[model samples]
Structures are given as structure tokens and as C-alpha cells.
Target: MDGDYVIGGVFSFHYYMHTVKHNYTTMPEPLSCAGSINSRGLRFSRAMVFAIEQINNSTKLLPGIKLGYEIYDSCASVSVAVNVAFQLSGGLDPVFNTGDKCSQSGMVLAVVGASGSTRSISMSRIIGPFNIPQRVADVIRRSTAKVVVAFISTGDMKILLEELSRKPSPPRQWIGSESWVTDRDMLRFSFLAGAIGFGIEKSVIPGLRDFLLDLSPSKVADSPLLTMFWEEAFNCRLVKSEATDRSVCDGTEDIKTLRAHTLTHLISTSNH
Candidate 1:
């Protein structure tokens, strides 16, 4: 009559079948990595928590059954992630609860922020120890979830695309907004095409300027690109505004002067 189940052990055929029938998919559940507060991973975690709550409240799943979750703050650190894994395996305190059940059925980890190739490799190495069971390890190693999105202007897009090309299994999709770049950036377009060759199924570029045009200046400026991209991608232009000249080149002379001064200072320091 015991409802508790201890995983990571050999199971009888009957028990295996019973658990299989009730369990979610066998994939290693996604986990989020973020700071303790004010992080994108935290927001994602909140949404997941809300969904589970709704499901349990409405009895959407098995009548009396409910979903359980455990959160670990990676602090965006691989060391923290490894430590978290150990803590979870040891039945440490959970961030959220599901009635009387204590441990989570599985883990969902998230990786946020960006890193270069070297940093990515280091992170992969840090998490390598936990990548046991060759099958699961292989999936994690080959997963595209670790890839990053770069939006630092079209010039930087070429470098990012080149890096992606070097990956064994490149991203399967590219999502961005029209404001991400100018049409003249052929390298960016070509990179999208190349990603498709490496299993990239689709590329999505959102149209956000049209939507922002109608919103108040403050609101438009405050919106995150990710949120704006989601909203304006589907031809939803809820804002209207008059066009005005707003170009970075307007202060080109000042920038040039600053650069010249910086170089002069550097040269003088070196001479001394």
C-alpha cells in the first residue's frame, strides 16, 4: 500500500509496466539554469509551475494524481549544476511541492545567457560527470539546446553562423525579428540556409517595428526583444506611431572624435 517509489533500481516486469503506463515521456526532462532571482530561467520555472498547478487543480491528469517539481539554482554555474544533481539525488529540499510527495519524477534543467565555443566546451566538460548511462549522455552531448542566439548586429551574425557550421549537429531552427538585421546581410541569410542542412527545420523572423509603432514610446522601449518577437511575429500590430529620424549615425562625428582621443591616449601611454 506504499505510494512511494524509489527509482534507479531494477524493477519487476509488473512494476515496470505499471509505472510506464502512468509516467510521462522518458526523455530527460528540461531543467532551467538561472540566478535565484530576476532571471529568464526563473520566469520559465514559474510558468511551468503554474501549468502544473492548473493541471492538478482541475484534475486534468489522473483523477487524484498531481505533478511534483524540484528547482535547483545553477547560478548559471556548471559547478552549481553538478552540485544540484547530487543534492536532488540525495532528496534535498525542493523549491516547489506537490502535496505529500517529496521527490520529483524527473529533472528539467535550463541553460541561459551566452558563451563562446571555449566556454561552451568548458561547461560541457563540467556537466560531463553527470552524463552517465551512455544513451542519455549521448543525447545530451548531441543536443542543440546548448546553442546560443546572437543578436549583436549583422556583422557579428557571420561569425556566429561560422561557429554553428563547425558544430556536429547544428540548430534545427532559427527565431528572430526583422529588426535583428538589415536585408543587406547576405551572410545571415546564407547561415540560415546552412542551418537547415544540419537539420534546421525552419527559420522565423518576427516583425516587431510595426507593432511598436502604435505603443507609447516608453512601453515600446521597455519591451524585451523576446517578448516583442512573440507578439509581433503574427502580424499583430497593436500600436501606431509617426515615423521620426532616429539613427545612430546622427552622432557619428562624436563617436569618431572619442575613438581618435582613445587611440591618442593609448599611443602616448605606450610611448611613456
Candidate 2:
């Protein structure tokens, strides 16, 4: 960012919801998504970076546009997405909190993100600024020409459909992605119509399976991203000071003890 560049923002759910605990002593320790990391979602996030890098290199795409981006992890949570949006817009500084949500740096031309419907909606409200964020808790309405699209799980779709029903907004067209694009239960909802989505396109990624199987403690130790993933995978904290979970990592555990998502963990280092 030393020279002229077009900055964009990327938001994706790199973590999957695992569990919520109400057993905390206080107002429930918000350990957000169990601090879990989804290997598949990690890959999706990498894809966005790759695409942006490609556009910056391409002479035909945006001939004069030297595109760069700031990526944010939404944790697949609506509330978290709002914080991200506020950060992106600089309207609410995410860093400084003095009982007043404000920040000195919030700037972005556009945002290419939000994997889920709920997240996408949350982002649009903050970005579009029809002052829609005030009603996110109880109501969500839109007054725009473009239709709202969604790419969420079946359960999330149910919540989104219910929210849309409460408002007077017209039935907006949605373009679906691979997830829940053709869900049988989704077809039952009248809110989503003409929701065309690409079905599963199978392709054998050569050498990918082998690369994943080859990962070991020795290999992961060199990578900070992998090391963090390992700790999250095992539900342990490698750093003694940052240890929030009861279980502590001795740093001798094998990487195989964590679930292997070759596609997911591979791209994490690229960002780091």
C-alpha cells in the first residue's frame, strides 16, 4: 500500500459453528464458534485472494486498477459480521472502544464477500446505509433494485426466510451457490424463487490427497497458520499465555490428531 491501489474487502466464514456453552460463570464467555476453523471454508477464502491477485495482474480486467484487498473472518456469525462491516466502513472503529463504538480508519471502495445469506444481509445494511442495521435484531427490510442472493446452510436459510417474511419487502431473487443451492427443504420456501445454483461439479485434484496425508508435526511447526489450526483442531492452546481452554498443547502432538482438510489448511499460509 505504498503506492496507488484500489482497496477492496473480503469477508467469509472460515469457522464453522460447533457448540455454544451456557456454563460460563459470567454472561457466557463468547468463545465464538468454539474458535473452530473449517478447512473447507479456509479454501474458499483463499480463492478470493487468488482471484483478486489475478485481476491485479491481468491487463484486460481492470486495465488501470491495481487491486488490493483486506480480508476479514466473519466466524459465520451475524453479530460478528456487523463488527466487520463497521470496521470496513470506518463508521465504527473496531479497534477503539471507549463506550462509544468509533474508529479512525474505516475505508473500502467495495466488498467481495460474505459466504452466507445472513452475513451478506448484515454487510449490505452497513454498506448500503439505508440505516437498516437498527432493525437487524427484529426486522430486516430492503429498498433496492438489485435482488438479494444467499449461499448458506439449510438451517441458516430457514432463519433468513423467516426474517424476510416479517418485512414488507418484495420477494427478491436470489442466486444460490453450491451450499443449499438445491436443498429439498429450501425448495419449500416461497421467498426463494428462480434460485439457480451450480450443482456439485466433481474434479479429482491430482496430488492433493497425497499432499494432505503427508502433513506431520515437523511440517506444521514451520507454518504459523498450521500451528494455530492444529491447536484449534485439538481444542488446545499452544501458547501458554493465550491458553483459554482447559487443555494445553505441549507442542508434541501429531497433526493427524486434528481432522485433515487438505484443501482448507493449505491456503491459510498464503494470507499469513
Candidate 3:
């Protein structure tokens, strides 16, 4: 593996089943990627491939070094994420505390994403040790792991908080996604004070706004994903703010300069 940068990636693309007992469905076991890829997982994996291509094509970023990656699926489970994390830590396959515990040098220099927080937390215990940024990593054994949390939903936030609360550390500086920035339930957690979050980042994607406004199922008959997204844009799957909880899709929505991103709102607690 004559690679320069080993960027480890994690994505949850499928639903996980606990047991494959006669009643349960069958699928690949932990530490395996033999299962069929899901739509969401495909989307994420493609994005990463596109990004790596862009980075490789660019001469400015890496200079002479090539950028490479090792992407794994978390299967939407903490146990699965932990399994993926060890693969990222190095070549620790079929790893058990009791047998064949030899860890090899993995090809990754840094990790990219694990959309769910529980997965992120479970993996962090392993991902935290490996120093990213090869030049500095060459000399240091232990360094600050740069952790970024994005698209971590409210449910995952609760699990993350509960885990942290058990072994309460010093107040951590938190960076959050718009998803849970203003969640009232989370605000009640005293430990989350001073956490900062970013909302969606909006940009005029030249003609994209117009395209979305005019988008319809008939227009995108070739793509099923786009068709469903069209409905999502105008349909209220969940409760809408200050409005009746309608069970129908209203096509009267404005697709203007969409609030693509959000502004950060600091949590006000008794002590920062």
C-alpha cells in the first residue's frame, strides 16, 4: 500500500438485525462488506469517490502525495461501527480480546464521517489513538484527535449524552449539526452548555433553484430517488411548525433561495 493519505470513511447504509435466528433475516456478519449496497449508502459512497477524484485531480492540495481512502459501512449499529473502527485502526481483522490480537499498520491517515453519533462514539475509542496528518503523526504517539460531528440526529444525541454522563469529563467544546442545535430536550442536559452548531450552508447552485421549483415526478421519471425527493420537498412527513399536521403533500411550496444551511445558536446554561 504505497499510499500517501489513508482517509478512513464510515457510513450507515443499511438496517441492522441483531440475530439471524430462524425468525430473523439473514445478512453479512460483522466485519464483512458482502451485503448489497443500499440507496443511501450508494449515495454516500459515490460522494466520497467523487471527492477523492477531485482531490487527486487537483495539484494544489497534496502537492506530490496521493490521497487514498478505506471506506466501511457501520450498518446503523454501534457494534458494527466498532468492528469497522478496528479495521480502520489498522489490519486488526477477526480481532478478539482473547485471540489473534495482532494489529497491523492500516492504510488510513485520517477518518472522514460516521453520520450517527453512537457509531462515532463507539469508533472514537479506537480512532482516537491513530494520529492523522502523516507528517506530524510520524513523530507523535498520542495527539489531539480532531472529531467532527455532523448529521448526528437527536436520538443519537441522547445516547451520546448518557454515555458521557456516566464518566463525566471536563466540559468539552462541542461542534454540532443543525439537526440538534436547538433541540429542547437536549438543552435540558446541563453538560451540553457552550456547544456550538452550524446550520445548513446555502449557496446559489446556478439554475438549481429554478430546477427544483419546476421539478415533478413526470419530469424525473428516469430517477426514482429524485421523484421521492420531490414529494419530500412539498410533503410533511413529520409535524410542521405552527401549522396543522397535514397528511397530504402540498405542491404550493416555494423553492426560493432555500435555507440550505443554518445559523449557530449557543446553548444557555447556568455555567459555560
Give TM-scores for every candidate, taking all chains together and pairing residue i with residue i: 0.28, 0.48, 0.42
> Against the true structure, whose TM-score is highest?
2
Lowest lDDT block of 10, candidate 3: 263-272
TM-score of 1: 0.28
Candidate achieving the largest lDDT: 2
Tens digits of per-residue lDDT for model 3 on 97-151? 2132123345567787786766788788754323133322222214243333435
lDDT of 3 at 100: 27
lDDT of 1 by residue, 139-228 (tens): 533675744333332223443445555553443444433323332344434435222112123332232212222333244334342233
Cα TM-score of candidate 3:
0.42
How many pairs of residues collide in each model? 12, 4, 5
Model 1: residues with Cα > 4 Å off, grouped in runs: 1-36, 93-272
Tens-place lDDT digits, model 2, residues 116-171 = 66777878886432323443413335455446566565446655666666653555
State which candidate, 1 or 2, has the greater TM-score: 2
Q: What is the C-alpha lDDT of each candidate?
A: 0.34, 0.55, 0.52
RMSD of each: 20.4, 9.8, 14.0
